[model samples]
Target: MIEATGLTKRYGKTLAVDNLTFQVEAGRVTGFLGPNGAGKSTTMRMILGLDNPTAGQVLIKGKRYRELKDPLRTVGALLDAKWVHPNRSARAHLRWMAAANRIPAHRVDEVLDTVGLTSVAGKRAGAFSLGMSQRLGIAGALLGDPEVLLFDEPVNGLDPEGILWIRKFMHRLADEGRTVFVSSHLLSEMALTASDLVVIGKGRLISQSSTKEFVSRATENAVKVRSPQLEQLRTLLVQAGADVTDSDDGVTVSGMDSEKIGELAAANRIALHELSPQAGSLEQAFMQITGDSVEYHTGLEAEAQHVLEPTR
Candidate 1:
């Protein structure tokens, strides 16, 4: 397990990470989510001991990363796929890391095959495509067969097939009882893969909760009702203490379930054209929750593409 208690970081006058505290338990994929400039990269660097924290601490298995006796076998991370030396062959790169850490040479080939880079392992890393480079980076991280893995934007440049493969791979790793901590801005992908979520903004923790709970809280339970007398139906719903809003062809009622709303319309003798529960998508919930936390504003740019809605 990985734990951070009151973890903080600062660069000169700017605080990159505030007093953040969280735990990544084993046997699950915990997604680290935030907009750009949220200090996720800084936090990952601090966890690996590559960047020192200004205050507080990060622990790997209850000890600092620098204090670990066998760090390679305990924690594996893919922070940056572009960090590979351009002149080095994939095999030679892994060989150097293994030799420095006393890992057997045979393990290099094993990881190479595991990431499907064995076929082109002889090629210089600079010639590899972005997706291939990403795979190579993952191969390097798995070289030690560590129980804890950290992936930062692992699918940044991957194609659809590559993205799907990684989604399954991350879940498979978690199924093996490993701690899988990944950081990404891909809300839809996170919804599909993560069991828990850690949302941050401006280096501060916005939420630390199970995926189900986070989505549940961010989304509203609403019912969509269509009727010839849409305005009358809206009034009836409002009078019944429901938060009503006008939709394109119907009215949306919150604070009431679909069945309950149907029953209400029936009792009121309102002729209904359609009635259905409105389930909010994960992307909607994410945008709602992180709306204020976005570091960069693009409201003007998006305005041209925005569709107009009837205000109620």
Candidate 2:
């Protein structure tokens, strides 16, 4: 397990991360999510001891990262796939890391095979494609056979097949009772992959909860009702204390479930055309939750209006 308490970082006048406290439990895939410029990378660096915190500290398995006897064996991270020596072969890179950590030379081959880079084991790091480079990075991370793994955008430049493989691979790691902490901007994938989420915005903790609970809490559950007597049904639903929003062909009822809506419609003798539940998506919930924490705002609507205004 990874625990951070009052983790804070600063660079001159800029406060990167502030009093961030969270835990990544074992045997689960925990997604670290935040908007751009939200200090995610900085926090990861601090966790890895790449950057020191200004105030607080983070511990990996109850020990600070720098205090570990063999840091790589305790925590393996793939922050940058391009962190390899350009001239080194995939096998050579893993061998170097293994040698540094006193990991057996045979373990390099094992991890190389594990990441499916055994075929390209002899290829120079610089010549490898983005997908291949990512695999090589994963190979290095696994070389130490660490119990805790941290991956930052591991599938950033991969094809669909590669993405699926990494997703399944993370699942396998978690299944083996390892702590897997992944940071990615892919909300949809997180919804499918991570069981728990550590969500932050503007260098502060926003929420830490199960993926299901986060989505349900951040987004609304509504039922869309379409009927021949739509206006009458709307009146009845409003009177029944459901928040009703008019649509072109139906009314959306919130603070109520589809079953209740259907029962109410049936009781009023309303001929229903459709009663569909609008379950909120991870994207919708993310947008709603992180609306204010975005570092940059386009304000595109205002720009468009200015363009349309009559020139003086």
Candidate 3:
């Protein structure tokens, strides 16, 4: 398990991370989410002892990262896939990391195979494609067979198949009772990959909850209702204090439940063709919750949105 208590980081005259506290438990994939410049990279660096926290503490298995006898075996991280030496072969890279940690040379081959980079293990790191480089990075992370793994944007520039492979691989690791914490800007992918989320804004903890709970709480719940008498249903919903938006097939409803909508239609003898509750999307929840936290705003969003709005 990984734990951060009052974790903070500061630069000269700048506060990068606030007093943040969160936990990453075993056997779960926890997503670290935040807007750009929200200090996510700072936090991850602090966690790995790459950068010293100005205040507070982050621990791995109850001990500071520096205190670990075999740090790589305890916590494996792939913060940047491009951090490897450009001239080094994939095998040469993993061999050195394993050697530094006193890991057997045989383990190097194991990890290469694990990440499916064994075929290209002899290739120079610089020559590898982005997808191949990502796999090599994961191979390094697994070199020590660590119980805790951290990844930053593991699928940022991958093809669909590459993304899917990484997703399934992380799940396999978590299923083996390892702690998997990853950071990414891909909301849809994160929603599918992470079971729990550690969301932050302005370097402060906004929420830490299961993926389902987080989305359900932040995004508006709406039910879609389709009827032959669509106009009648819209008028009824508005009169009953529900927000209604027209859709191609029907109307989307808020401030009312499916049961209530069904009752209204039945009472009026309106024929109902479809009634389904819309699931909250991760993108919707992120935009809604992180509206004020976004560090870089184009300010053109409103203008762009106005251009898209239909004429009344």
TM-score per model over all chains:
0.88, 0.89, 0.95
> How do the residues 41-68 of candidate 1 rate in per-residue lDDT, one tens digit apiece?
9999999999999999999999999998
lDDT tens readout by residue for model 3, 167-238:
999999999999999999999999999999999999899999999999998877889998999998889989
* Candidate 2 global TM-score: 0.89
Clash-forming residue pairs, model 2: none
Best-to-worst TM-score order: 3, 2, 1
TM-score of 3: 0.95
* All-Cα superposition RMSD per candidate: 3.3, 4.8, 2.7
In candidate 2 the C-alpha lDDT for residue 280 amounts to 79
